[model samples]
Target: MVNLINQLSMPLVEVALVLQKHITALMTTLQEHLDAAQQSANANVVKPWPLDVEAAESSTNFPVEKVMKVVDSQRMDILETLIRVTLIEIDASIIEGLLALRSWEHLVRTQLALAKGPGQLFSPLDIPEDW
Candidate 1:
């Protein structure tokens, strides 16, 4: 039988292996962010936004199914969908924070894919721009 690892270039294979280690940690972080959001919602949703948003913020119900899907897959795309859908469900006029957490995660994966693909610089895997 052909080895699956052999199908990938060694650097990319290693990157995948490295990323596998973070699924659990990222899940924990995902939960923490959700918890924080819940806390903010519980405390004062209007404060998280701005202006007279009490009317707009009165209703918010994150879909359990979508959230559970992200929890199961531990994928950023799924989480992004959950965030976007949930915000839309609540009719959020403006979001206070951006979700570049997933984008940063994606950039790391991209860098890994380009590890040996071409002229790639050794960019530090640090937080990109902002969280």
Candidate 2:
């Protein structure tokens, strides 16, 4: 029986390995970006029900009331921005995962082609010969 590794095409295997490495690197970068964004969001997130709404409503001084409203509005804006950025980072990570999966599938196909033959690799409409 032939050694399986010997039957593998070296150049094709090397290319697949390079593609896997690049996909891994991309996934790492995406995860790092997501982690950083999540950390920022956690740091800035404020739990509801702590604001002094009753005090602000009952306050007679115009200046104090206006400052409180402005501060609250600004905080809301910052939270919204954080949420949007975090979501974008998460989406990027998902895309990276998909890319890695596709690369892995390609590697499987190539390996199968090397072990068997090109005709046995993939067919969308027909089942593989091994099955």
TM-score, candidate 2, is: 0.29
Q: Per-candidate RMSD vs. true structure?
A: 17.8, 27.7
Over the stretch 36-111, how does candidate 1's per-residue lDDT look in tens digits? 8884333222211122212222233455454334332333333344445654676643312223223333544555
Alpha-carbon lDDT, every model: 0.36, 0.37
Query: Across residues 1-131, which tens digit of lDDT does each residue of candidate 2 receive?
Result: 01221233223333333334444555566557768888422211111113222221232323544433433334334433443355466775445444434534354444434433222222221213442
63: Cα error in model 1, Å: 34
Q: Clash pairs of candidate 1?
A: none
Q: After superposition, how far is residue 56 of candidate 2 from its true place, in Å?
A: 72
Please report, as a residue range, the 10-residue window in candidate 1 with the lowest summed lDDT.
1-10
Off by over 4 Å in 2: 1-10, 39-131
Per-candidate clashes come to 0, 0
